[model samples]
Target chain A: MSSRRDILDLLGENARYTTEDLAHMTDFTESEVEEVVAELEDAGVITGYQAVINWDALETDAERVRATVELNVALDRETNYGDIADRIAKFPEVTSLRLVSGDYDFDLTVEGDSMREVSHFISDKVAPIPEITQTVTHYIMESYKEQGTEFDDHDDDDRLSVSP
Target chain B: MTLEPADRVDAVPPSGIRRFFELAEEMDDIISLGVGEPDFSAPWAAREAAITSLERGQTSYTANKGKRELRTRISRFEDAARDLRYDPDEEILVTAGASEGLDLAFRALLNSGDKLAVAQPCYVSYVPGATFAGVDVVDVPTRAEDEFKLTREVLEASGAAEADALVYCYPNNPTGATMTGDELREVAAFCREHDLVVFSDEIYADLTYEHEHISIATLPGMRERTVVFNGFSKAFAMTGFRLGYAMGPEEAITAMNRVHQYTMLSAPTTAQHAAIEALDNCQADVREMTAQYDRRRNYVLSRFEDMGLSCFPASGAFYAFPECPWDDADEFAEAFLQEQKVAVVPGSAFGAGGDGHLRISYATGLDELKTAMNRLESFIS
Candidate 1:
């Protein structure tokens, strides 16, 4: 049972770790590991697996732009902010959405092909939402770190040549 | 004029482990299980502390014994964990990793021709370090049948009673054998009866998986005679930081510090600060890493069973010592590396009892370990 939590933790760090790899790491049989992972996926414990990429390192010209858009919405007498949040979450570009306290009713992370597209999405789609009273978008300039992994600088193995 | 090295230095063989590393370096696409250090980097907090210290211009050499804050922290840590109390000011001496601590203990305590009894299939450093100190080493061979525990009978048979001191490492390097407190009591009694000083190397203390690691020093009448050498290398993955400490009777620590004062001067000032931070705040990180090592250790043990290799389950450390079908471990290791491209250290690299066994480290990523195991399966078959 504890292996379930352990698997999630390991996969959370690097989802690329195969079921076989996870089995070896967690001391579970390959089939057992497969069963638990499938159960996790079925139960919504594992929502998705992602590749944490340093986009700046890519040589391609077409780069994806990301921004965090905070929204302040009026709690509807009939349906609360959940109705508007549900509408905003349906956008394909909205990568993450969370109902948060302190000023913003919803915190969202949105991604698009370019900064102009992100701006267009906010001005065209987000602005038209009657329930949302205020919307603020902060375009991320650069990511020094993402998903708890550092990308700006590399950690070198500084250990001695022969340390026994 | 000829540049001649000392006869004593020439007598000791160069590290057998280094040869395999060199072979792996020259080869292409070798999956090496030969590394002894942890694959993980130092926890960010510890590294940040060192960086912060350096940024604050705290680069001057610390006192010969090391910073009082680190010593005090180590003292408190030992007291809480091992039930061994040490005076931060006088009973602790930080050195350049546990390697230096081992060296300092040998140099400070042993006179020329003094016999230092060391367990075989142990860390490679014990014999060479003793030889460098001009001390004679009596090999006490522990068997896989005994789970690699240094027995009273084995010690007596090896004539350890004639030795001045005993150098013991539990959750031992290469073997990964650990002794329970109850099991260690007999050895402790023997050490007491024989009036032998004990240099207990507990560097792998934090890596024990089966049971809690016990310090022989915590045994009755053992603290005064035992010098406990522990460090951040194996536990906190702070090998590069070069930090370790020795705790013993004030006199022994003073003696070690005397040599330390003349030689190493002091451990790295930045590392000492980092160690203080590690002891104070990194228990969770250590626990998490230890769990990972445990899983890997068990996985390797299971793999060894599936391969039909006789392996004693390692209770501590990150190595799995499995007896090979071949008689000559060195030849097997060489051939395996050359043919299969999977690198493992031969047991003979450690000492006499290490023959016919290969020490496979599981410190690498699980995927790499699985690949190595697959290749090993193919090679052995």
Candidate 2:
């Protein structure tokens, strides 16, 4: 049997490669490729495919502001921070949420249309949670790299056209 | 006035591997499994470091031995990983690439007619490089049964006793064969007994699949007599950066440095900076790339088996040399490329005893590799 993880790894790099292409790469027949992909989609292993865009490079009227908010949470015997974390995660504005070590209990990244929108997300939505004792927000200024990909194109690939 | 090329230049034959590359250059819809370079770009952090160095105006020739910081990083990296302690200041000399390091080692160690023992079905450079330096190369044909390893018996049988030095490449190019630590120790013992200098080309050290790469220099009493050549090309996907280094005795390093200084002033300053960054950070990236190579290697091996071709499973590097169905590998390679639009190297290009084999590189993207395999199946059938 061919590895399902290998298919996922290739898709993670470039989802645009066709099933036929994936078949060739993974040594799976085209039908087998389709079957494995369908299974992965049904199992929720592959939720969706989306483009990785550089928003800063585009000239647009509306721009998104992103920030990481650290929360000091108080936990009780039952439910604990799970209930509150689930509540925060349910918000469409929350991009990622995680339970972190040290002074903060939950570290979250939230994105909004503007700086005002992000501040409003903290004051109106996040701060209102009773279990959250305190919150600290840090806005992302610039990104040199994200998701294991470098944004800069300064040094191009320099391998010979053909070499052995 | 007409000028004549040097007699040595005329004596050396043109590389057989270059013919297919030249043919592919003229053809459209050609898929090449010939090139040994990684299809992936250099890690972003490494590229970014070069850019940052340029922005900071750090463009000039570096110290003849390379920047001190980079040397120290190489020393530390070797020491931590392989227990090889090379004083960066005295025993290491940065080179343009492992190619240059190999050339320099040959030039420094060999005088006219000095005999050098080399394993066959290896990288294409060793024989020609030795010949260019006026050294007579003694061929030791490693068989497929031995998994292409250089054993003491092979050396003794090949008249290595008369040779002044020996050169070996593990995770060997073309064959993709690698020697284990114990296996290498026996070879090291033989070298000691013969008092022959050893040149170890470890360009593919980081590309090993199943086991950790064991440098011969790390063996007992061999460090002083061995010159280890490694580079950023295969490992970091930094072939264009042209950065490599040699570690050995102070005297040998000094001699290599003397040749390097005269031929090449220094490796690019920007590449040196990027190499430092690659060593300091980018372990995760290296692991990611290596994982991809392993996946491809396994896929190729299984495909070869399914096709009923006899292939020695490669435990290192990104190449697989499988016995071709035909008797003459050169004819098979040329015909396959011409008819199927897929390119592979004839095993004979490497050296003696490589006939009836084809060298396939899995360094291309997975999709391309798969396509190449399908075309190969059609060609064979």
Best candidate, lDDT-wise?
A: 1
Candidate 1, residue B145: how far the Cα is off, in Å:
1.1
lDDT of 1 by residue, B121-147 (tens): 888899999999999999998988998
Global Cα lDDT for candidate 1: 0.88
Question: DockQ for each candidate?
Answer: 0.35, 0.24
Reference-based lDDT, each prediction: 0.88, 0.87
What are the per-residue Cα lDDT tens digits for candidate 2 across B42-136?
A: 88899999999999999999999999999999999988877879999999999998989999999997898999999888888899899899999
- Expressed as tens digits, the lDDT of each residue in A128-150 for candidate 1 is 88888899999999899898888
CA shift at B34, candidate 2, in angstroms?
A: 0.8
Q: Which ten residues in a row have the lowest lDDT in candidate 1 chain B?
A: B295-304
Which parts of model 1 have CA positions greater than 4 angstroms off? A55-59, A156-163, B1-3
Over the stretch A1-164, how does candidate 2's per-residue lDDT look in tens digits? 45998899889998997886677556688899899999999999999998876677778887879999999988777757789889999999998999988988999999999999999999999999888899999999987777756687565434443576
